[model samples]
Target chain A: MIQRSQLDLRKFVAPEFICGHGALQLAGRYARNFGMRHVLLVTDPGVRAAGWTDAVGESLTEAGISFTIFDAISVNPRSRQVMSGTEVYRAEECNGIVAVGGGSPMDCAKGIGIASSNMRDILAFEGVDRVPVPAPPLICIPTTAGSSADVSQFAIITDDVRKRKIAIISKTLVPDISLLDPEPLTTMSPELTVDTGMDALSHAIEAYVSNASSPMTDVHALEAIRLISSALPAAVREPHNLDLRFSTLLGSLHAGLAFSNASLGAVHAMAHSLGAACDLAHGRCNAMLLEHVIAANYEAAPDRYDQVGAILGAAEGGRGTPAENVAAFRRSLGVTETLAAVGVREDAIRTLARQAYADPCMVTNPRRLTCEDLERIYAYAL
Target chain B: MHMHSDPPDDRDALREKIIGLGETSLHKSYYPELQSRLAELERFRALLDQTHDAIFLIRADTGRLADVNASAVTYLGLSKEELLAMPFASLIAPHQKAAFLETVRKSNEVPSGSRRTCTAYLVSREGREIPMEITVRSVIFGDEQYIVAIARDITDRILTEEELKIKESALESSTNGILIADLTGAIMYANPGFASIFGYEQDGVFMGKNLEAFFATPSVGEEITGHLLDNHTIVKETIGLRSDGSSFHIQVSGSVVQNDAGEPLCIMLIVMDITERILTDQMKRKTYEQLGKNIEQFAIIGDHIRNPLQVIVGYVEMIDDPLAEKILEQSCRINEFVTQLDRGWVESANVRQFLRKHGDGGEPPLQTFIHIGATKEEDP
Candidate 1:
């Protein structure tokens, strides 16, 4: 029983974004509008191989702009790679950034922009609003439909030293523009498509029940939930369908707008810890831990969780509970990996629990979770 | 001004920021950086204006003024709008717009950071022209190319150079040997006269040689340097050693040149060759000695003549004949002549004393040569 009144103060921020088939091609035009002279094109090997990097490069070249391609990125962007990309940005005298990949490259591009503008190491900006100076112009062209890092004001970089992911949270991390083109989403493999689709579903669920959720965020969150629950299964079945891909892209964008404003809960906090500890995929970690976190946190915000359950429950022909419906949805999308199946051992749960307990994303959890409670949650996922 | 908060307080602040409530929390607007960058540019502009050199930013494509500094206004005696409206080349000497266009083209042909310098006269608003050394460099900011012209007034430098040339001519053609040496007695400069006197070419190895090498006694040069260091000036006659190992008299007058702080910088010595004067002095001394001996001989000869005359008078008294009387008279005459010879000797000795007192190097007395007034003994 959460009640909202018009008197309560709230704020919403979304980047200037364009959505359609040719949205990614308009990156160069938007970059020029932002006064970008030379740009650093950030992407991964997969995205570059899929021809997104070349297409964007052609667009920039046609617009009479210069760019340097830095494709040294992984599924989980490392602080080392972020700093390396920053080195390229400075060495080439690039004045702007264009990220053409999934969340890893986009998040890494955000990290690079922050580091280059602040003239410091990326790890120094680990806390919230720590960046006193904003990064240069950033344009994101997300290939996969997850992470929503293109629209979200969050950049997660793995600190290779501590073997964990550090979050740099600032409104400044929001990109200047997001080119939401679903054509690039057709090139994702079935597993990547499933994993990324699950990531979008987790974002909507966590944001809808978050303590920081507002009327504005709730509208985007519930709609995101309804869209993802209905489209994610069919999106995995027909990975090449533009309509299915566009639905997922639109759903991720809506969820990004929701969570970017409302923030996340124990699921993201625990997921960041698990992803960093196991060296696993971020989407997979979220997909594995999403149901477990929902079960543990169901008692804190029952009414909000009930609304979320109704959308997912309707998809499952009215299921048992919100947590059960989420599990069934993840399974239907063919994401059925347990924590141990992904190489997460039982002994590492306490350290993972302690780290998640301290994550900034944990601050918005509906229920305050202790280290012991998080350890039990990790155990349940295992 | 900045106090560190407690850890819990830090966490609280971070949470507030995570919820977008911190003082610095905002979306990526770039307003602050824009404000800071604009302020920095203003500071840089102020710095440019503070300099005495006139700075100009010209659009490379149009050869037109894009910007100008404060000094440019003061130099051209024109308002900012007036300067900006005119073609940049119109401000140059003779208003050669085509020439400046070519210069800009040449400057742009080189690499971005390289520059080229040329001398030009800047025609002012009052029609007065100022000589300037203009260094032009091509610069780029974003999409537009600009030419940065930094003009420095060279009037003072030109005048200084002309004055230096005149002084150098004087040193080159001087008749007196002028030598400049460091405090350590090493020769730094020697004028043409100095090189000629020392039997060395103007570009010879004598340069960088110690001043002691030119002194007959090396220690004489050292002593003079020490004296000049302590006393600041010295004028003494010393022996000089020529290249052929010959020594001659040299009159050297020297002084230490100091900077505005009154600290000694170098030694300047003016030397004159006095060997002929010394030789002439020795000859005059020898002649005076010989003249003194001749006068003494005259007195001795007078004594011998008188003695002989007296003996002849005695012989005449003994003879008692008329021949004897004649002989005695003749002897008396002779004795009187000897007395006159003695008087001549005394006069000659007085003349020698007078010559020693007033003669110029064995010449007769100045009054005797002029014959302005005869001496008391010589007057009739």
Candidate 2:
């Protein structure tokens, strides 16, 4: 929707990625290309329990890549976990890393690689371009349908003491290869499937309306919206349908590509603060706040939102506002929840608003937001 | 009431359905995986404790001391348990605590993995202030954010640096011109004295210039280079050319600077302008030569006058007349005067002395008879 003359200079970056029913099988081959004799395998206990970690590990063993499993990572991966993983990597003499799980494991793996190579505390690499060197050879096999950390130049780690999530953005954070296998989605619960599907939807919308969005990113962003809107419901209803799961996985991958290049808007900014403070699921927070952020930014990027509405099957030739269309879509997925229901309190709105306004994602938000505006949004969501 | 009655009978069936969904969502057992990772976590703690620099882990939000390593306990002069129980500010010097806190705040505000350095002082248990260069970075461990500060004591380094600065200042302000040139004769450094000697007001004007350019001729440059190449210190008088194309005599003492391995690194040339000293030496030589010639000439003149006067004295003494005695006395007096001049005693007034000795009067009229141009007669 942005005119050619109005387009600014931009750059795009993404990891080499493969997506299919069994793309997880390629993790070993990619690790071998990096000449990894021994690798540190990063995953959360949840992913390990789901048996995806074993599948990836078996492939590594088949390829003769010996590995040490580091399954201490948690949701919203902590810096301590990253440091602990780095210790394991150094102790085991791992030359490479293979992350198996969702965004949390991938991000934790990136943190481990950075810490191992730089030999510094993981907290030192928090902002854009803060990483001075590339992480060790990393291959990500994402089991979740959302949180495209495998291909993104971003690693969101929770600062437990500060009760916040720190965004570490650098090109070095992007994995060497992202092997996304949709087959893993069949094991996810219906709640997780719905949550991640909405997360993918929010990524597409936010990327499309972001101030940094370019023509290259817009194509992927709009296509992601169409794919997610058409496939998320079916995938949620029938988790074992490989075709529906693969469609959602591809949609999430495209959305990741879009946002990784164009960045995201206030939806991510607010969700990061809310999720960090309240310890909620990242995807659910994004889903709950997407419509409100779109409503606030609709006037600033109306045409961009109109296209998003059209992709989501809004009536009246997509002439209706993006907020209404997104809200309707979210309701269709049975995700009607207020901020209060998600553990956000009226008293904590001020702190959450201040932190959200300070998030790095706020730089790419379509509309300028202040702490007051964010507080009002939080209040409205509640 | 009628609508609710229809659904009441299916409560038991609904519970079973809910239980089945819960069973399906439950994840597999993770206890075995958690047990193995706990050992790795212990290894991580040991690794942190072994670092040489005193390391402190403080909570990013509260500035509480979460952990301290063995080195920190030794450096702070406190036990590990005591150090861990204290606040982060307790280790910082009172005046530096504010700056330390501010640096911690900035480290927290920045993204994880970004490091900031601050030079601050820490208070040891003995109440001594130890200067430390601390590097602070935010790290998340477990579920909490912490600032990992690595502090290194820099007291010795600071003292060494201060001493080096003083020595450097002395060399820069030396009076004798100094130049350091590479093996190929390209000048690398020229102190102020070296610049001023070459009529350059700025020292930088001499940098990167060939040292041979400052010599009066190529041959002089070659002679100095040969001596340096032989690893010998050579001190010689030579001519040096200034920037204005004028040459002056200079005394140069040069030696080759070598590394610990005895390989030549550079040539150091110490030069002093000795033109004035050379001119003074030349003048002294000319004056001495001229004085020697004048003494020789005076001897010849004395021989010629004294020989004739001696003959006159001998002839006048043999004739016993009063006038003959007068002539002998005057001749003897002239001979004495010639003797004085031959002895280089021209400052003595021998004519006045002779007149005063022989004249029959209280005060002889020596002024009336001894008249010379610009020479006033002395009082007798």
Each candidate's TM vs. the true structure?
A: 0.56, 0.51
- Strongest candidate by lDDT: 1
lDDT of 2 by residue, A1-382 (tens): 3344445898999876767767788677667666678989999898899999999999899888999999998888888888999999999988889999888999999999999989998889988889997787788988878898888898999986788999999998888778878888889998888888888888888888888988888888888888899888899898999999999999999999999999988999899999999888899999889888888888888888878877775522334567878887887888899999877789999999999998899998888888898999889899
| Residues B248-310 of candidate 1: C-alpha lDDT, one tens digit per residue | 899999999999999999999998888888887777777776765565566557556767777
TM-score of chain A of each: 0.98, 0.96
What's the DockQ of model 2? 0.01
What CAPRI class is candidate 1? incorrect
What TM-score would chain B receive for each of the candidates shown? 0.70, 0.68
Instruction: Kindly list the per-residue Cα lDDT of model 1 for residues A44-75, writing each as its tens digit.
Output: 99999999999999999887899999999987
Clashes of 2: 18
Candidate 2 per-residue lDDT over residues B239-356, each given as its tens digit: 8999999999999999999899988999999999989878866665464445445544665686689779878888887887979977877887997787656444333335544534
